[model samples]
Target chain A: MFMFNSLVENNLKIISKLKKSLARPDLGAITGTILVFLFFILVARDTGMFSLEGTMNWGIVSSQFIIIAVGACLLMIAGEFDLSVGSMIGFAGIVIAVTSVVWGWPIWLSIIIAFILSMLLGALIGFIVIKTNLPSFIVSLAFLYILRGLTIFGSIHSTQKTIIGGINEVSKGDWLAPLFGGKIFTGLFTWFAEQGWIDVFEFGTRAGQPIVDGIPMMIVWAVVLVIFAHFLLNYTRFGNWIFASGGDAKAARYVGVPVDKIKILMFVFTAFCATVFATCQVIEFGSASADRGVLKEFEAIISVVIGGALLTGGYGSVIGATFGAIIFGVVQQGLFFIGVESSLFRVFLGIILLLSVIFNAHIRKIIIGKG
Target chain B: METPIMQLTDIGKHFCSIKALSNVSIKIIQGECHCLLGDNGAGKSTFIKIMSGVHQPTSGQIYFSGEMTTIESPRSAIDSGIATVYQDLAMIPLMSVMRNFWLGRELVKNIGPFKIMDTKKCNAILMQEMEKMGISLHDPSQSVGTLSGGEKQSVAIARAVYFGAKVLILDEPTSALGVYQTEKVLKTIAKVREKGIAVVFISHNVNHALEVGDKFTVLCRGKTLGTAVRGKIDYAQLQYMMSGEKLN
Candidate 1:
């Protein structure tokens, strides 16, 4: 009888511990990320998806996604939506290109002006949403269309076509271009090449060139943003307010938290991040098209949701969203490297999003029941 | 009277032509649980809102710590050491107990240029305050939704006391709680009173109020019926007064 009692007690303890761990919102996202990464690494081994060069290719793409996803994750945790982010990216890129190329403005000055204008528009959206108390989904959805239309109109007005080019040429002599968009760690890569640590084509015109030359600026920006956001969400009082405002605005307000202010700041931050991504991409690609960044807002929201942030708001981790972006980057690049149809990528995204929602809901139910 | 901590005199409120509260007066003394009893629509909510600075009374005078003061906003009221624990307790259920304990006025330590929340200090203070309320939580990091309804109330009360509130207003704290939870909340209120803070307890249940209140003020139809000390008025008289009747 004593043995039976001990066994039951031990089982109860184990169950309680598991419940405690699962109660954390990030657990689902972490599990999803691991499973996806392992699946890709296993299936695409022959495609060199695990190679340094392959990693670099996906890393660059994922970093761009992470920049906006981190901001969207924060905003979601504050209980708002920013469907305008994708359109804002396109709009910001056009603004940067038009000012620098069409108007002969300095690239650095155009970048600054574009960022400030995007932030102002973001603040306006936040103010209107707060004042009107309308659902943010509806508010941002309207902005999505408005900004996209404006981008197209502005591009036609400036370049006469949907595409605007020569931004790379325009930024040739600019001092900030190298810092914002070019490669870094070239010296380290060169040392690695000298030591024969990097892969090289055995017998081709590109035989002497190392496959992994240097780390791109995009990856660096993404890493910096991840670290910065993690600290902001976990260590700051503003972070607490974000959770509080998203969790229960009414309750937060009663406790003297500036719920409205936190939410407005979140909206503005999301816009600023969209601009950051636009700036980086414009510098790297040397042009902007009105159609660029199409449907990116949905991708960002999906990344945030997969990162364990609830659609209803009030629980998420920047680290988890970073993993979510990694998952997206892996799948996107893995398919191309493995000779799968590129269009099938969207199908994978849809499935992952659906599965994440179901898994998160199941985990929440268990935690709530046990709690 | 040792100078009542807060005094509301002839407080009146009107919503257009509708009178929500009128000529309501109450004096709250330190170390006392002054029960403000009223039936539904008896102006209890309006009176508390006015006291908490949610609304401005059309005609009234408020005295705080022996001086005339105007509570222009909820933030100002909190700054002036007035804390209100609403029916919902104003707590985020998903947040940890420690986080909820220091939601608005979180303690921060500056590291470099970043002002980060001092989780260590928040956790320690939360545990200490909760223990003083005669409730021992196994883990301060546990989400508050896991706590019993009575425990949530205790956390709210303990948070208010920890913040050095001179006047704590509780709005129907036990209305949704079970009988056992209600008992626990009443005990917490007594403990808070022992700390020498004036408590404004709003409730309709005279029995619950009598269990912890030192004095009682009954409101009916936007008017103050009367006030009585614990020993002076029995439960029968309090119930009758609450039911819109008066004794000769």
Candidate 2:
């Protein structure tokens, strides 16, 4: 009886520790994401579409979404929204295309210029919002339209056309492209064109082939961003300030948190992430156009919400949002394999969004009741 | 007998056309719990705001440690060792107890270009402070949302104490608490006083005021009714002063 009682106590202690670990806001999102992936697998298996190849294909395609979603989560946690990410993607891609094709600029130089331009645009949006105290949604929405118009207008003026091809062909020829997106082990598994690079290490290859050996470069980027974001949110002084600003601006100001600077930094980071994803898209597709990243902002926001980030501000998790993006990717790819209509996929997505809102409300009720 | 740690002399505040606080004067001595008793709309919040530097007084000066000073903002108030814990407590419910404790002043370890939050240090300090206050927190990592009303107030008080607040202003700390919870918060107030920090206890509950207060100031209609030493006045006198009765 004493032994049994000791065993029970040990189990209770383990459960208590697990509960404490899972009490984080991001835990719900992570668990929900795992469930989503599991559902994807079930659907894939039932449809005879489950395969390692299929998983790799979806992973490559979803990497961009995952990366952008990390930044979107940060912006949301800081209590703001950036509606211009979709347009910013197109703008960055176009900048790369114009510099490389029209100006005959080096690939490296084009990437640098495009990145700088995207960051500057992000900073401008942030500056305006901070100066005016206007809603970020309204400001970013306006910037979205403005950038969209500019992308189309620039396409018309520079190339005398809206669609700019040759990026795919150029990517195939460039040494940098193969470094970013080359195949490994011949044809063991066709890796992401941009994530197949080999990095030197003392023992052997530190970074492996995109698909066969290990995680993709894009996924690596996403993970790095997530880790940085986690540190920023949990450990950094600025991170606390961001939470305080979002939680209660008046209280944050009362406690001397430099709320305006945090909000502005968030806005800039959102655009910068869009730019990074845009570069990845261009490298992968080898093309640029006004419609390169249509409705991407919606995807980012959906992923953030699905990951369990609060729309009201003061709460979010980069890891959760990344998983949320993966969930979207799984659903998108899994539905295709199941022969579900693309339009039906949208309907499913909408239902998931609504369900997540309901789930959030329920969780809040439980938390408040327990508290 | 000695000069008070904080002295408010003829502090007045006007909101557009409404005189929210007019000619309010009070003194808070070190290690003494000063109670400000008033009903709703009696300028209790307004007076506290001025004291905490949320609003600049329309006319008059504040004296911190007996020297006349200007408190332009909440930062200045915090710098002057004055911390205000309001009824809502300004805490993020989803945040961990330790994070909430060190929200504005996080302990950071510099790593090259980056500064990382030292969770280990924060947790250690939080546990030590909470233990010192005789409060047993089951988990420092638990979200503040999961804590009871009394626990939340205790965390706020402990946070202020940890930050070296010399004059702590508590706005109705026990109003939302149950009977036992109220006793818990009163004990926390007593604990703060024991740490040699001057406390401003603002409440409508005269019994609660009498329990922890060493000095009592009553406000009625945005004006000071009177300030009395705790032992000098009984509960009846405090009740009469708070309710607009003229004490002969």
Candidate 3:
């Protein structure tokens, strides 16, 4: 009987420890990521989905989500939302195309201008929200329309058609384009192929070349953004001000925190992320299109929510958002690999989003329950 | 005679057509807990706002350290070493106690071009300060939401004191606390006084006010009823003034 009592006490201690760790904001995101990976590994084992090539394919897709998810997570934590992110993407892409292809400007100059313009627009959005005291939701939503409208107007005014091609042609040999469009570590991959470590092409002019030559800049940006965002939120004074601003603006002000400035900066960051995404897409597709980023704002928000960020603000995790982006990439590519109709991806998104929201609400209750 | 740390003379505030406060004057001295007693809607909030620079008085002059000064904004008010801990306490519930303690003025260490928050040093300082102030805090990472009402107030008071608040204005610090917690906060007030920091303890609780208050100022309907030192005016008279009843 004494032995049984000790065992029970040990179990209770472990349970208490588990409960303490469970209070993390991204508990749901971490669990969901594990479940997703396990499911995909079981079902898509024979489909080459875990192969280097396949991994890179889904990784690229996930990288796109992670880039924007980082920005959205920060903004949400700071108690604001940027609905104009999608439109900003389309608008930025057009700016690049119009500047480089149409106006004969250098690719580097085009990219710089795109960033500058988008950030200014973002500042305007933030300024209006603060001055008018309107909800960020309404202000950004209005910008969503204005930016998209301006994008279409610019496209029709310059290129005379919706799509503008030749970025791949014009961007070649440009020093700056490669940072967004090109890849890195080809020499390492070649060594791996020579050592019979990776698959290599065996026919024609491309014979003996490694199939997976290098990591794309897009994926590199995503990884860098995740690391930077994680460090900023966890190890920076600005991060504390972010939590303060969202937690209680008036209280933060009383304590001398500049809530308005931090909020406006968050908005600018969202635009900066959107521009980064636009540049990557234009490089990858070798073209610009008016309808490029439709509904992307919702996707970024969903990824953040799935990562366990509270929509109400003042609590979130960058790692959680990264996993959420990975979930998007894996599930999306997994469905296609298993011979399932890709359209079911939308259905999966809806269900997962609902589950995540429910899970996040439960987490919020537990956090508050401690009080 | 020692000069008061802060003085407000003939302060009046009008919100459009309504007069929130009129001809209100008060003096806060060094190392004294001055209680501001008033019933609801007696211009208590407006009075504090004017002093804290949240709202400028339509007619008034503010003298700080015996020098006439204009506090144009909350930032300037904080710069002048005047901190107000309102009922909300200005704390983020989701943040750790240390983080909330240093919310705005975060301790940062330089890394090349970047400034990173020094979490280790912040935790150490928070523990040291909490211990020094006699507020028993076990973990610096414990969320403020998990703390009891009195503990949260103590955190706010401690934060104000640590940030070098010469004049600390607390709005109903004990109203939401239980009797035991209220006593704890009163003890904290005494601790602040020992350090020579002037305190403005605003409350409607006459008994609580009588316990810690060295001087009492009464406000009734946007006007000053009277001001009295603690020993000179007994509890019954202060209670009557708190009820907004004027003594002729």
Please, what are the lDDT tens digits per residue for candidate 2 over residues B36-137?
999888999999988898889999888988899988888999988999988885567766788788887889888899888888999999999999887889
Q: How much lDDT does each candidate structure score?
A: 0.88, 0.81, 0.90
Q: Candidate 1: list runs displaced more than 4 Å.
A: A1-7, A200-207, A366-371
**Top candidate, metric DockQ:** 1
Once fitted onto the true fold, the runs of candidate 2 whose alpha carbons sit more than 4 angstroms away are A1-53, A103-109, A127-134, A166-217, B110-114, B245-247
Each model's TM-score, in the order given? 0.97, 0.86, 0.96
Considering lDDT, where higher is better, how would the candidates rank from best to worst?
3, 1, 2
Rank list by DockQ:
1, 3, 2
Return whichever of 1 and 2 wins on lDDT.
Answer: 1
Please identify which of the two predictions, 2 or 3, would achieve the higher lDDT against the true structure.
3
lDDT of 1 by residue, B1-248 (tens): 37899999999999999999889989999999999998998999999999999999999899999899899988899999999999885578777888889988899998888789999998888888888899989888888777888888889999989888999999999999999999999999998999899999999998899999999999999998878989999888988888888654
Candidate 1 chain A lDDT trough over 10 residues, lowest sum: A362-371
Alpha-carbon RMSD of each model: 1.7, 5.5, 2.3
